[model samples]
Target: MYVRSQSDDIYGDVWTEEKAYCVEVEVHRVQDAEDLLFSPWREVSWTEKKREELRENLTLYKPSFEALSKVRVLLLGPVGAGKSSFINSIRSVLYRRVSLLPIIGSVSEGFTKKLKCYDIRAEKGGQPTALTLCDAMGFGDSEGTGMTLHDTLAVIKGHVPEGHKFQSEASINFNTPGYRQSPAMEDTVHCAVFVLDACKVLSYSENLEKKLKKLHRMISDLGIPHVVLLTHVDQVCHAVQEDVQYVYTSRIVQERMQKAAELVGLPLSFVYPIKNYASEVSVNCNTDILLLSAVNQILQAIDDASEDYPSAPQEAETKR
Candidate 1:
């Protein structure tokens, strides 16, 4: 008992009961598409000037504590969440070129297997910046895959040595080769970033959700500042795909970002949407600006956490 509208002619008069229902749903969806493009939920400057400001800020950033020469940041997330790609994007923005120092894997595979830290430089062959990005294997939903909980904790504590390959069944311990029994303060992670796929936020499996929650609790106990980088935003909303600046305004993207925050047990402000350079031939200003903004926020978070440390020269000098 269905009456066809003028738009229903697109089906070519061969509509069955199921087809009729689908067509009706499609009609309503198309009619309401405009509603999904909400007003600017978050304000972000999408201009070249803002881009320059962010870039310069990151380039000139220095740790508040003089004892530490560089601030270490650890990237953590589920498999194929663009952790390596995000690093490359940051490097590209800082270096002003398409830099691919970190090896990237397919959407379902993890390419980074070892615990390695990368020193970012503002220019090629120039002095490294004050920021060090540490890359590690992605976390898996199952017990015997990806990185183990112990290994993650060890890395945060600065005990795991560089170039240490992650083991599926075991974690690096005191007897492990090249392990740092007493790591310096500068070696420890000042910030932890959890990169997640925007499209998969709502679709995460039960096991994956449980794993993330557990990790969140452990990281929280350490009192380290953490944030979530919601990646692959372009794939989630059409408006964002057409224009990267439309990320915060798109209702779908905002909702997904909120869900991502809840998934990681962090505040909405801590969840940032980023689009890594996946298949681009060259860098774009909009993309660079977003990446720089995320890095700027991370540095701010690191500074906020450093405020609690003792200011005495003895403790600072010894820790360094």
Candidate 2:
């Protein structure tokens, strides 16, 4: 929308030089897709009643996989993209209190260094629920940093045992003491969640994008379901910052959703824009609804994938 002018040195001499016209930059404007809208910046359709219903549904549900005991979801993203924060946010909602189980802090060189897994339980000191989240080291711009392909495959195939420390210098081998030689269906990852910051959706570095695309192809070849979580929506959009419910209606969020979908080669429906509990002391209904909704969809994907798993029986239903 604006023009920039500059001059280049024609006759160059340190003391005296003549300038010539250089290239002018202009017409570089970014615009959101034009879509007809009836409402102007209002709360999302998800109401308090709906939030309560979803909370109850999520808390009481159990996986129907007769063979597998829990559905495993993998979390992957770059440094400081809020992967650990997302898990903590989900725990806060399910526990109905402030839970900081996963230690989250500033990403100087990626906070997590080992493979970790958490069991989502119904209540405090109760049995584990259907969902299980596994987190790994964050990816970095430079090579030989973060997780390598070998390590990623190890986790996806369920060979990399929980609490396996990631070594940037070398990948884990079968001879490693704690490596799981034979991983069961329950141990393998069922759904892959690519967590990304909404503020950087359109500005991801080239190196990061290449790594993501490479991982995407490997995940697709396995026929595993993929979902994208666009976090930190409040930082990008002002309206969403004021009220979490306005995320759906904000143009900025919608654009980020579209961009994230294209970046990860997923459909719009699979891309979820959510706000994690960054500094909140208590649980918010709207935030809980958004986070729980994403988890609900992931559980559904796990259920769908379980139908074709060889270990599962034909009647993969929980006998109440």
Candidate 3:
């Protein structure tokens, strides 16, 4: 059952033939649970004579000029927990179509958001994408420099317990290519977003858990694709913790953030609750539900890395 209809505007389809997806997927358990069987209004193949030209083109697609740019996102947080106001609220809400994307890497004029990177491109063909928004200067608000904790224990000793070190690894090279001087921080980071601030841990009664296990061992080497962006969540759902008891310190910081994502294995990762584009009379510059839950967690990471994004089994209208 598939009914087709679109009246113009897939948002400048970029080059026309249209194709932009970025689903990496490696939960092994659950952070998404197949996002309700994939639902972005599903259906986007269009071929039967363009189904009468896709109902005239279909509002030129607009998820705020969309740009997951193929998952390379590294928006680690701590400093003011806003990350340059969520990259200036996605370029002032798509202003200049994501600041005319050549790779959005030049927002910090002074306040340390250095080593900038947005570099995203692809609509009709696809290839150029970087997306490195490392606001790690205030590493957990202490102002450290780059990835610390001995660079996350030299990449978690080559992924702990992943097959007993693959039979001794012969010598210890592990695809070495000049490590990380600036080859763009040794790339390959699909998603490590963790910007939680929920009112500074809802006043912390006792849920820091050794500072979230030292920021989860300094970003758990992106283990199991961590993605917790719980910014403010509009003051944790419009404030009412047992009539102001403060919901038992936000439920012990959500059971120590779900036991630090199950001791870094990941039975739960992708959490969303954001609010803060800006303008709540700037006490410290807030706006929350975690900035629209970090804009719906990067549009669900561009709809789980879209491959033209569609898969509800098939039901545009029961396909006529």
Compare candidates 1 and 2 on TM-score and give the better one. Answer: 1
Global lDDT of each model? Answer: 0.83, 0.78, 0.38
Off by over 4 Å in 2: 1-44, 312-320
Model 1 bad stretches (over 4 Å): 1-38, 107-109, 311-320
lDDT per residue for candidate 2 within 59-136, as digits (tens), equals 776776776666788899888889999888888887888687746878578898888998877766677777888889
How close to the true structure is residue 197 of candidate 3, measured as C-alpha lDDT?
A: 64
For all predictions, the C-alpha RMSD in Å is 7.8, 12.9, 24.5
Tens-place lDDT per residue, model 1, 173-281, is 8889989888877767888999999988988877777777788887766767889999999998887787789887778888899999899888899999999998886
Model 3, 1-320: lDDT tens per residue?
22233346645433333443435534466532332232322123323333223222221223321432233444654446565556554443323122332322333322443334453332223343333343333343221333344433333222111111211122224344333322222243444566656666434323233444565655442332346665444454323221222222244335444543443334444554445444433211122222323444554553454333232111211232
Q: How close to the true structure is residue 203 of candidate 2, measured as C-alpha lDDT?
A: 85
Better of 2 and 3 by lDDT: 2
Candidate number that wins on lDDT, 1 or 2: 1
For candidate 1, list the clashing residue pairs, or say none: none
**CA shift at 246, candidate 2, in angstroms?**
0.8
TM-score of each predicted structure versus truth: 0.85, 0.82, 0.24
Ten contiguous residues minimizing lDDT sum, candidate 1: 19-28
